[model samples]
Target: MIPARLAAAALAAAALAVLPAAAARAEVEVDPTRYAALGDSYSSGTGTGDYFDETCLRSNRAYPQLLANGLGAELAFAACSGATTSDLLSKQLGSLDAETDLVTVTIGGNDIGWAEAVTACITPLTDCMDEIEASETLVEEHLPGLLDGAYGAITNRAPNAAVYVLGYPRLFNGERTCGALKQPNVAEQVRMNQAADRLAEVLQGKAEEHGFTYVDVRDAFAGHAICDDVAYLNGLTYPPAESYHPNEMGHLNGYYPALSRAIA
Candidate 1:
């Protein structure tokens, strides 16, 4: 018979040997056969260049494309610029189906008039507070139902898919910088970030209700927000449409990796 000490040693060694295999199995495993990308401008990659077309403005550098490529999954790219939650229910849900194995979304910005608020906040002499306050009202009263409808539609369309709802980053680092274009003051930035936080909270709650994963990018974008030395988000740019949206690197380093970690 084996000695008690020898048996204990053998058991310890066996447990250690089993750990590495378990860790290997635990490594990021997203092998989607068919992926669907849904939601608004962020998902469509409006700020990132190299669009598939003017209609959807689906960029090659979008996180969805990067994720699909990384997983070697066939993608149904339905996200579009200027898309509202209503648009998701009406237009984007067509791309998803039971065959879709994975899905990702970034919506609610347009619904809350995020672009309009940002425009007011950054533009010289504009009373950004009014826009922000109005957005806050929408956030409290209107956004929940809108998000529910949109998320519900997504689940219905992709009943068997693993859905990921990605939230937007807070666009500012609570700093003020006077560059070629006007920047939102520290106060404006703080308020806007607060609004963004509220939006994210709403998005997360809805995503959770639907049994979908909600990936928050606020921490991922902490130092990379506008006014940072190396901003992943675009400051007021020429195209105007790209203003305040995540850049190519933001999608690559921020959104892509955030979603990757969530999937893992």
Candidate 2:
């Protein structure tokens, strides 16, 4: 009887151990009451074109709104159209606090004059490579410290939040240059994509260092670049602010899904 009882106790202990391991493999469900979307144009939905607040270009079609609505969480949308890392620290961080339990940010492009570089690429006689090379140098030299300051501020403000630092998508398909006038050629497009890749690499490292999840959307937007049949990003649009930004479908299909997969 003693031997039989001992075997039964050992079996029960093993079952308990197995249950925990099984639970660990299950999906992570983040149900936060206070969610803050803080960053630049990507989070603001600049290219989507249905802006409720023109100053910030906040759109209903943006990924933040979509994600917030999906999770049934109250959102403090603080992203603006032309925000840099410095802009994020000064203007956007106001939305986050200790009570905030979820935060998502996509920044750092504007810091290195990404838009200006694209403009130079599209201008008739300007040397695009020189401008792109300058931006790349800033990415290597200066953007890290700027990101560190912004990220540190976020962690400090939202101590309990599950923060996600989202990276930018590669804007070009790289096979064909399809836009109208003075568009980046195939070779230029390839280099631009390489710059995007470098930015993602930097963003991923900084995010991980700060104990936040880094969501890379390059893979998500792979076949959906500007020249693709079903392009997620805008290619030199009319209101130049919208140029090179993700359209509504991009937020829906690319950014939102990448973020969803990260937390889900």
Best by lDDT: 2
Relative to the true structure, how large is the alpha-carbon lDDT of every model?
A: 0.84, 0.86
Give the TM-score (vs. native) of candidate 1. Answer: 0.87
TM-score, one value per model: 0.87, 0.87
Q: Taking the tens digit of each residue's C-alpha lDDT, what string does model 1 give over 123-198?
A: 8866799999999889889999998888888778878778899999999998776567556888999999999998
**Collision count for each candidate, in order:** 0, 0
**Per-residue lDDT over 69-183 for candidate 2, one digit per residue giving the tens place of the 0 to 100 score:** 8867789999998899888988988898877878899999999978878888777656689888988999999999998899999989988788899999999988987767747
Error of 2 at 260 (Å): 0.4
Name model 1 segments beyond 4 Å from true.
Answer: 1-32
How many angstroms is residue 126 displaced in model 2 relative to the true structure, after the best TM-score fit? 3.3
Model 2, residue pairs in steric clash: none
The lowest-lDDT stretch of 10 consecutive residues in candidate 2 is 1-10
Worst 10 residues of 1 by lDDT: 1-10
Root mean square deviation (Cα) for candidate 1: 8.6
